[model samples]
Target: MPRLRANDIEQDKIARFERIKKAITALEKQQKQILKQGDLAPEGAWVARYQVSQNRKKYWYYKLQVPTPSLPCATSSKLSKYKHLGKAGTQEHIDAVMSVFRRSVWDEIQRIIHTLDDCLLDISSGSEQEEEEAQD
Candidate 1:
């Protein structure tokens, strides 16, 4: 078998990279639109406010409360700290706390899915290109 030329390998690599980059850009744009839609959170779901201490500092956290049969009560699980107030019920308040939480959740899911989709697209494209070249 003959060895591959340096120029041929470089060109192949460049083509693969461009294909991967384009797929990633498209996936990122789609993910942004998904997050922007903001339909992840269910309508009329109650969000609770609570205070959690971290590193001896009090911080305000919010969580979505879903009524359950076993619990029969709204249980608050810590989600994220308010951007302004360090603790719950602090003087520094944030407007539309529920909206903030919903947005954060949407953004996080979008980011994770975007990364996975980009990686899969890159690998599949690269493999297909390699196979096509091998057959030639």
Candidate 2:
């Protein structure tokens, strides 16, 4: 069997990323369905609470809290805090939170693809230079 070329490897990666893109699209579409079925709440919880301000005014607001571990080297003895998400009880807020998470994942995928492209460019250029030198 012959050794695989760079193009062949890149083709495989491209196909894999395309499949990942499809999966992301599917997840995005299911966001609404999951929310309606109350399946999304398994990931975190939300609350509507009243608070008193310095002016003695009371107001009720919704917040989404997620339990996560504190920093590894934190001096505080507390183990975790309920991370404050955007305002709850609204579709826009939920979408915003989801977008934030999805954007992070998409950004990471783009970064990896960029790194791969850079590496392939370097390899192709080096091979081309070697071929040119041999011809001279």
Candidate 3:
């Protein structure tokens, strides 16, 4: 077996780095596709609670705990804290759940893209350092 020279190893690393870059580009395209899927209201959290009616019939209700936008010199008030989404199994409830699920998927894709970017940076920097040492 022939011994691999430092230059040859560096070139191989560069090739792999380019491949990763292409993969990241593809992920970005998919991210855009996700945005175009449906309504992406990625704000607030869905809340579910059980309540008893006057006749002691227990039922579940869903609400969205939307955070009020902060303003300058705003007082601590409980205004527009939660918006009712009707009872469970309703269209509003189902839509809310699906919105949350889509947001989670979007977040995961962002995390993956960031990790790949970091890896590319690490590999490029290592290669630069190696080249500097080889010149000395």
* Candidate maximizing lDDT: 3
Clashing pairs in 2: none
Which of 1 and 2 is ahead in TM-score?
2
TM-score of each: 0.34, 0.35, 0.71
For 8-104, candidate 2 gives per-residue lDDT tens digits of 9778656755665565556555554444543233133333244545667655554434455431223556654343433455674665456445544
Over 1-136, each residue of candidate 1 has an lDDT whose tens digit, in order, gives 8888989877876776677677667767765775675444343334567777799998667554444422222235543222223334443323234454665665665677677566667655665355444563
Alpha carbon lDDT at 116, candidate 3: 92
Which residue pairs clash within candidate 3?
A: none
Model 1: residue 136 alpha-carbon error in angstroms: 41
Worst 10 residues of 2 by lDDT: 39-48
What's the lDDT for all of these models? 0.55, 0.50, 0.72
Full-model lDDT, candidate 3: 0.72
lDDT: worst 10-residue window of model 1? 78-87
Full ranking by lDDT: 3, 1, 2
Per candidate, the number of residue pairs that clash is: 1, 0, 0
For model 1 the local lDDT of residue 28 reads 71
